[model samples]
Structures are given as structure tokens and as C-alpha cells.
Target: MNSLEKQVESAWKNVDQQKDTLISEHSHHLQNSVDEELRTLLQSVRQLLDDDGQQLEKDVDKLQLIAQQFREGVEMWQQKAQSSVKAIEEKQRVLSLLVEDVSVRTEGRRESLIQRQQQRVADTEDNCFRVLQGISS
Candidate 1:
């Protein structure tokens, strides 16, 4: 039981560590990308007055579309992560119930076996007593 507890604790720590690593990596990547894009956008804005106004408006619209898609992708990732957590929790709950049931059944069987062993010992003692009495007579 102690070993099992240790294993579970280790597993939980691993999960937490992995989650933190992923979040940090994801944020770092996004931040670098955003910095690059912002620099590019700033350069474009500086030249906007020299370019055709209609073309500038179209480019802005395109950028808006790309931003919307990025947001959708991030939302989808969040939903998937949440669903995975729920599924793992449900599996853990069911497994715990199964282990508890097995433990209870094993306990009942152990008590039954102990009673049978005790009865056998009592019977052997009675036979020994009778034999000793006959010898004395």
C-alpha cells in the first residue's frame, strides 16, 4: 500500500509538471510570434499613407481574418484539454471503485478461512483429550 501511494503521488506530480511545461512553452512560442507580427504590422502602418487606401483596407481585413482563425484554434485546444482531464478523472474514479470492491471481497474470504482454521484446531484438541482419558483409565 505504501508503494502504491508513492507511485500515485509520483504520477500526479508528473502530470502537473508536464502541464506546466506545455503551458510555458506554448506561451513562449505565441509571445515570440506576436512580437514578430507586431514589428511587421508597425512597418506596414508607417507606409500606409504612401500606399493606395483601398489596398490598405483589404490587407487589414485579411489580417482580421487570420486573427479570428487563430482565436478559434486556441479555443479548440482548450476544449480538448478540458475533455481529456474529465475523461482521466472518470477513469480514475471507476478504478478506485473496482479496487475497493476487490478489497472487501478479499476481506470476507480471509475471515471465512480464519474461522475454518480455528475450527480444525478445536477438533484436533478434542480428539487428543479423549485419547489421553482412555489411556488414564
Candidate 2:
């Protein structure tokens, strides 16, 4: 039982480590991507402002496209992060419930075994007493 508990604890620890690594790696990647997109957007907007006539409309369109792409990318990353968090939270909840259930069952079984052993002891003592009385009589 102690070994089982230790195994469970070790498994949870491993899961936690993996979750942390995944979260950090994804978050860093998302942050870098967002930063890069922002930089490009800023550059595009500056170019639009600096450029002279005729192709001014094209520059404006390009800036708008860049902004739109950045918005979509950020939104996508936000959704992914939210989903990942929700999944991890659900798993954690399940693990907690499982641990609680196992602990309760183990305690119940231990108590039952202890009661049975105590009863056996009491019964043996009573039998011994009866045998001694019969011999004395």
C-alpha cells in the first residue's frame, strides 16, 4: 500500500513536470510569434505613412492585411492556451478524486481487518477460560 501510494505520487509528479514544460514551451513560442507579428505590423504601418501617391492605396491595404493577420494569429494562440489549461485542470480534478477514493477504501479495509483480528483474539481468550474452568471443576 505504501508502495502504491509512492507510485501514484511519482506518476503525478511526472505529469506535473511534463505539463509545466509543455506550457512554458508553448507560451514562449506564442510570445515570440506575437512579438514578431507586432514588429512587422509596425514596420508596415510606417512604410504606409512614408510612401507617396499612386501606390498609397496598396500600402494602406498591405498594412491592413498585416494587422488582420496579427489579430488572427493572436486569437488562435489565445484559444489554444485556453483549451490547454482547461484540459489540464480537468485531469487534475480527476486525479484528486481518484486519490480521495483510494484513500477512503484503504482506510475502510484496514479498519475491517483490525476488527476481525480483535474479535478472533477475544474469542480465543473466552475458549481458553472455559477450558480452564472445566479442568478446575
Candidate 3:
């Protein structure tokens, strides 16, 4: 009976050791899985950051194109404005010349009209004197 009891104790100790070994292996496997998940999360974050950088670069390129277009448009507008200003200055010069010419012509016409009125008055006086002389005769 003593030998049978010793055999049973030995068997129980072996079973306990197996159980401890299995628990330790399970804990190691769980830690490895957690490490793998953390690594995957870090990689995804890095990829996201890289993608953001690429998108920002593209945006900057688009803004540069827009700025170039705006500059060209402004340059064109300035050219057109300068041309319009030149045209307006020429028109003003022509208008001033026309006004001067018309003023000179108008003054000449007024002087001619005054000279014709003085001649008409002299002819009327001469006719009146002739009538008076014929009556005296």
C-alpha cells in the first residue's frame, strides 16, 4: 500500500509540471501575438504618414500652377490697360485739335459778317442823298 501511494504522488507531480509548461507556452504565444499586432499598427501609421506627405506635395504643385497662371493673367491685364491708356491719350489730342480749328473758323465768320453790315449801311446813305438832289432839281 505504501508503494502504491508513492506511485500515485509521482504521477500527480508529472501532471502538474505538464500543466505549468503549457501555461508558460500559452503566455509566450500571447505575448508574440500582441507584439505582432503592435508592429502592424505602427506600419499602418507610417504608411498613412507617407501618403499624407505625397498628397501635400501634389497640393503644393497645384498651388504653384495656379500662382503662375494668376501672374500671367495679371501681366496680360496690365498690357491691355497700357494700350487703352495710349489710345485714350491720342483721342484727347485729336479732340483738342478739332476744337481749336472750329474756334478759329467761327471767329473768321463773325468778322466777315460785321464787315458786310457796314457796307450795307453806307449804300443806304448814298441812295438817300441822290433822291434829295433830284427833288431839288
Candidate 4:
């Protein structure tokens, strides 16, 4: 009877150890599953951030291209405007020179006409004095 009791006690101790081992294994598996899920979530978030960064870079590149085109357009317009202004200035200068030449020619013609009129008046007066002298003789 004492031997039977001893065997029963030994069996009970073995069962308790096996139960502890099983509980430990289950806890470890649950922890591994939670860690795997956390890792997957972190990877997905990283991928999303990478995609957003790439799109941002593309947007910046487009804006830079547009700005460069705008600057070029402005430069072209400025060049054309300057060319037009220069052309107008040249035309004005040529017109002013022509006006000056015409004024000088007109003034010379007027002076010559005045001199001729004065000579004609003197000649007529001399002819009349001779006629009066002839009548008196």
C-alpha cells in the first residue's frame, strides 16, 4: 500500500510539469503572432510614406519646369519690346533731320526773293527821274 501511494505521488508531479510546459509554449506562440502582425503593419506604413515622397518629388519637378518656362517667356517679351523701341527711336531721328533740312532750304529761298524785289524798286525810281529831266529840257 505504501508503494502504491508513492507511485501515485510521482505521477501527479509529472503531469503538473507537462501542464506548465504546455502553458509556456502557448504563451510563446501568441507573442510570436503579435510580433509578426506588428511587423507587417510597420512595413505597410513605410511603403505608404515612400509612395507619398515619390509623388511629392514629381510635383516639385513639374513646378520647376513651369517656372523655367515662364521666365523664358518673360525674357522673350522683353527682348521684343526693346527691339520695337529702338526701331521707333530711329524713325524719329530720321524725321527730325528731314524737317531741319526742309526749314533751311525754305529760309534761303525767301531771302533771295527779298533781294530781287529791292533791286527792281531801285531801277524803277531811276527811270522816272530821267523822264522828268527830259521834260524840263
lDDT of 4 by residue, 1-137 (tens): 34534564575567557755755565567557655755675566456656788676665556556655755665576567557755765675576557666767888999989999898888888999899999999
lDDT of 2 by residue, 31-130 (tens): 7876787678767666666666547757667767877787788778767876887697778768876987888899999999999999999999999999
**Candidate ranking (TM-score, best to worst):** 1, 2, 3, 4
Highest TM-score among the candidates is held by which one?
A: 1
Task: Tell me the whole-model lDDT of each prediction, alpha carbons only.
Answer: 0.76, 0.78, 0.66, 0.65
Task: Write down the lDDT that model 4 would get.
Answer: 0.65
Q: Comparing 1 and 4 by TM-score, which wins?
A: 1
- In model 1, which range of ten residues has the least summed lDDT? 1-10
Ten-residue region with minimum lDDT total, candidate 3: 1-10
* Model 3: colliding residue pairs: none
Task: Please give the TM-score that candidate 3 achieves against the real structure.
Answer: 0.55
Cα miss at 39, model 3 (Å)? Answer: 40
> CA shift at 5, candidate 4, in angstroms?
99
lDDT by residue for model 1 (1-137), tens: 55555676677778778876886688668757865885687568657936767777777777767766876676687668868976886787578667767877998999999999999999999999999999999
Give the per-residue lDDT digits (tens) of candidate 3, residues 60-123. 5665566567556755765675577557656755775576678678989999888998888899
Clashes of each: 0, 0, 0, 0
